[model samples]
Every structure is written in C-alpha cells, then in structure tokens.
Target chain A: MELLKCETSDIENTEKYILKNGEKEIGYGYIKGVEINPIEIFIYENERSNGYGKLLFSKLLEIIKEKEAKLLTFDLPEEQYRMINIVAYSGGRYISIKNGVRRYILPIK
Target chain B: MNNTILKFLERHDFDLSLIKKKCDLGVKSSKDVNPIIAKYYIGKGEEQQRIYVADIVGYDYSYMNLDNSNIIDNMSYFYNENGDGYSTRSLSLLDIPTDEIVYRLMGSFTRDPMYLMEADKGKYVIDSNGLHRLHILKAHYLKELSELEEGDAIGHKILEDKYMVETMARKVDYLKTYSSFLFQQIARYYGCDFDIRPQYDDYGELTGKVTIELRGKNEKLVLNDKQFIKLLKDEIANFLNDNSISKKDKKHFIDFVGQTIEEYDSFKEYIKQNLQEIYNECFSDEVEVG
Candidate 1:
C-alpha cells in the first residue's frame, strides 16, 4: 500500500488521501475535523480493521507535523462507532452532543 | 467485536505481543490477542474463550438487575420484563464477548445512528420509545459450556427473536448511508447478514410491517466531503439569507461555537481575526465566503 499526503493548500474542510493497493484504489481517507490529526478518518468498510485506518491517521500526522503543526485536535461524531470508542478510550473528553453532533476532541500537543 | 476488544486493549496501553514486543495494541494492533483472552478463557476447548469471556462481560451489566441496582437508578425505572416491545423474549447477545458489545451498543450514543437515541440523560429510545436493551441484549447472551456446533454463527437465536430485528429496521431511515453502515457493521460482527424488507404473514398476507433478515453487507459509502461542504455551505447561506437572521443572532451563533469549542487552532484564530469582522460587516444578512 502507498501513502500520499496532500499539501495544506490542497486541504479542503475534510481533507483526504486515496488509499491504494498497487494499481487499485482500495479506499480514500484523510484526517479532518480538527486542526491537525485529532479524529476524522475513514477506510472503506471492506478495508477496515486491517490496520489501514491507523496507518493512514499516522501518516497524516507526519505530513501535518512537517507542515509546522505543533499540536492537533479531533472532534468525532458519536455515531461513528469505531472512532467514538477510539477517542473515548484514548482519553478524549466528551464536551457535548446535544447540538446535533457529539464531540471528542483529543489534543495532541 | 474482537476488533473492538483489540482496540480497547490497545488504547488501555496493554502489551499486545504477550511475548517479545511492546505495542500500543490499538495503534499497533498486529499483536496476537491471546495474551488478554488467556486471562479469561479458562475453559479447555472450542467454546472456552467464548463462554469464559461472556462470564466476565455479563457481570458488568449485573447492576442493571433490580436486586443489584439502587432505587434511584434510572435503569430501574426503565426496566420492563414484558411490555410493549418487538418481543419479551431476548435470547442472545450473539457471540459478542460481552464488554465489547456494550461499547458497540453504546456506539450511537456519545453520537450514533438513527435507531438508538438518548431520550434523556442515560436513557435510550428506539422508534421514539424506551427500550431496555440491557435486559434484552443480556437475555440473549449464551454462556453455556460446550464445543462449537456446526452452523454456529452468532446471533442466530437472537435473529429468531424476529420482533427485535424487524422493530429496529422499522426505525431505520435510509437517507443516511451511515445507518446502513451501522447495520452492516453490527451484523458482520455477529457473523450474520442484516436486511430490511416488506413484512408478510405466514399465509403471505401483507402486515405492512418492515421485515428484517440477518444478512449481507453493502458496498461502503463514498466520502465526498468537498462536495458535501459546498452543498452544505450553499444551503446554510441560503437559509441565513432567506431567514434574514439578524446581525445579533449570527454573532451569537459564532460566539456559541467559539465558547463551546475549547480546542484552539490557527484556522479558528484566522477566522476570528480576518473573517469574523468581514462577516459581521458584509455577510451578516447573507453568509458568502471566498
């Protein structure tokens, strides 16, 4: 698998990368919902739990750090099952969710 | 479910390799899970791990029982043995190793899909009604000591509790792809397929109820956040412009977001310094950004 991190100029609100296995596009995701790598990530369901999500998140962090981010944050939606557990278990605080979406912001300083 | 446990184990900083390595079991999940399972899988055979883990997991929900619960507990107020439900029968938690199911069960909360909701603090709703899922979920967990039987997919018996499956599907709103994803994930974990279709009686009479089958995973949803944001931004701008939200309300909304979000970012700081004033001066009546 290959990891490609786009530049900040290429960063949209929810920036992402194409996850490929050789010539095929297996999945696409990038860390978003925070200033740096805090919480948002996605790998196709068929490709989940295979260490891809974690690997992608880690790679995104490297790119962001190289771009001069001293800290990062994440705000995960509660219904995003895998991430909710991930953030909560990682000591992400539950600030609120009543405003429509739950928040678990992990500050990587 | 195994994946969730492995995730939980990793986050807790448990050493996954059990032998020669130190890994953050979740981030570095390649470690063999046998180390943790060994602590609970005290039995000798095929079902040993399954049954042993269930015992430990089942204990966490024990507090939901009246005998074990306090009078002030909200669970006590919601607990119902036989009442309005898909069925009073809850015979399995599938093969979910207990604790992980709790996390899965709580998935929709802390933010989740359409079927489950927190009606109030610590309360959950299905189809706008209360559901004591704890009783039902636990009622279905199988902790019996035995060997693996053929065709032994987990949640088979629970699926036999047709009312539960159908009821959940009935509440599902298909507009959100995540809802289907949730169904798929939950079912896949149980080694079952989940489906929703029109309900029919034994004689082929249309009951008008949505029927659900424990089967099949769907293709994953495409993530097009850039497109979604463009649409959402347009929608929000239109709403703000059409509604003529006053300068006061707009600033209040921005301030609310600022106060609520404690984490700081240079982007947010940039918005506050460069954009907030421009928005207040020019786009207060209409949200248009460059």
Candidate 2:
C-alpha cells in the first residue's frame, strides 16, 4: 500500500491522508482539529471488504501517535458495523450512541 | 455574568451543574467578557435530555470570536490544563496570529454571534461552536490578501498605467478588507488559488485580465472573474443539493451565509459611496500618470 499525505492548508485543521495500491486509491481519512477530535475514515464502495479499511486505519493511528495526540476518537453512523468492528478490535472505548451514530474513543497508549 | 441573565436562570430553576466556571484567563472587566450560554440535547429518542450550558460553550454551539478583545487580552486562558474550552494546542493547530484574528473578527459579526457567560470573576471566553466557519473565513481572508500582495509585487507595469492602476488599486483596496466575506459564503467548500496577471497588447498597454484557478477535490477549474463568480455559485448550489448533509446543518449554513452576504453587500455599498476618494489619496503617489 502507498501512503499519500495531503496539504494542511485548511484553517479548520482537517487534513486528509490517502492510501493507494498501485495508483488505485483504496481509502482516505480525515484527522480534524488540533485536539485530534473524532476522525472520519472511508473506504470506497468498490474497495471495501478487502482489508484496505483496516490497513488505512492502522496507518492513520500511527499518524495520530506521531502527532502526540492523547486519544483517537470516532463518531460514525451506527450502520457502519464494519468500521465499528475495526475500532472495537483496535481497543476503542464505547462513549455513546446518539442521533443514529456511535461514538468511541481510544487512548494513544 | 449579567445580573438579569443570572436572575432568569434562577427563576427558571436551571440546574447550576450545567454552568461551568471555566473561563479564567484573568481579564476582570465585565464589558470585555461576553458570556456563552449553549444548549445541548444529550442522548436520543426517549432518553434525550436537553441541557443548557452556561460559561462553557459546547461543541455544537461553540461559535465564538476567538480573536475578540476579551479572548486575545487573556490569551493565557487557552494554556490552562483545566480549561477545556480552548487549548494552546488548538491555537497552534491553526497557526494564526492574534492580529489576523482581530482583523477577521471585524467582519465576523453575523457569522459568529456573541454568547454571554460570566465565570471566574467577570471573566469569560468564546468557544469553538463555529470554529470551522471562522477558520474558513480566515482562510479565505488570508488567502485573498496574499494574492493581492502577489499581484502588487508581480504586476508593476500594470500599476504604472495610471487609468488602469487607478481602477485596480481601488478594487485591491476594497478587496483587502471585504473579499473574504464575499467569497466565504460561496467558496466555503472549494480550494481556490488566484493568478492575477497584467494582460498586454502588442503595444504593451495593460488589458487587465485576472485568472482564477479553483481546485476541487478531483478537478481543476480555470476561470476569469465573471465566469468564476457564476460557476462558483452554480457549483456550490449543486453541492448543497447533491451532498448528503443533514437538513439542520444545511439550513444553518444557508442562514449564516445569507446574513453575511447581506452585510457584505451593505459594506460594499458604503465603500462605493465613501471610500473612493480615500483610495485615490492612498494610491496617488504610487502610480505614474505618464
């Protein structure tokens, strides 16, 4: 897998990182705010179920650690069971489920 | 905290627990401090509870004037360990300066409403509710200023043309203050870069064609001024229509943008009536009438 870092030009403090496999973009995710607030990860419909989501997620976790962020948080739609599973497997703590979304947080270490 | 608001909260039997005494940067003037009172709906469906937060602004209603005189004067508030409202890390994350924020704050009135919350002895701070919007506005403001500066440095010959220079300088001066407000409403979702050049004919007279380069996530659009405005409006409308954004979020965005645009139009009208002479006075020495 190839890692491509996008620009941090946004004043909103949201940056995107892309994971590619031989020029075919597999997945992307956003790391938001200086606080390293809840992140959003997406695996293209055509690229799902192939473990790329997990691969992209692991890479993102490393980035959060490199940034020295205290925790990794996720606020995702409840229907995203696969993503919830990945977070659970990675030790994300259940925070709450509100307005059709599940919120979780994982300490950096 | 204002006495009237406090009495109202007391009369309503508002739980004191909802009010957090977190804004402690140490500025003791009451007028300088604007209290933040935010409402949150915790949980969902049957268990949902509505809570009004005083002093500490919640994330949803966190729109604050981060560069407000009260906040800037008490910058140390962001460095405190217990102050969860804002942190030094968050300020550094955006890497913006106090002066720049103050400049942006002048035009952020409608975009960021004042929230009143008294805590820690007449001390209060703005929260991050509309942080993303403020940052977007700041981004557009800074980006446009930088572009104008670039034109100043590169288009020397363009400025030498007295007639053309007069018009350009006036527009540049107008944009220095107001362009960001105008662009923020429509260009909020797009990444834009401008390339303004002094177009010249065979005889070397300036024709004044400025190029705007707009980059979206997957495409690059190059447009002149007229085309750029029309296309940008159309594209943003299409984005609002096609995207899966929640109705509440969409309405919030539209309402804020609509108000700011009105402010922008009124300011432009004011400048048209009052600032023309001032612009001429400021730029007269810089242009060569030959």
CA error at residue B164 for candidate 2, angstroms: 85
For candidate 1, the docking band is incorrect
> In candidate 1, how many clashes are counted?
15
* TM-score quality measure for candidate 2: 0.27
Task: Give Cα distance to truth, residue B176, candidate 2, Å.
Answer: 56
Root-mean-square deviation of Cα positions for candidate 2 versus the true structure, in angstroms = 22.4
Evaluate model 1: give its TM-score.
Answer: 0.28
Q: Kindly list the per-residue Cα lDDT of model 1 for residues B119-167, writing each as its tens digit.
A: 2111222321123453324332321112224465664443323212211
Please list the residue runs of candidate 2 whose C-alpha ends up more than 4 Å from where it truly belongs after superposition. Answer: A8-11, A34-37, B1-290
Fnat, 2 decimals, each candidate: 0.00, 0.02
Residue A91 lDDT in candidate 1: 33
lDDT per model vs. reference:
0.35, 0.40
Q: For model 2, how does the per-residue alpha-carbon lDDT over A1-109 read when each residue is reduced to its tens digit?
A: 8878887624366778888899899888877764323466788887764567777878877887788776666665645656765675465543333344555566676
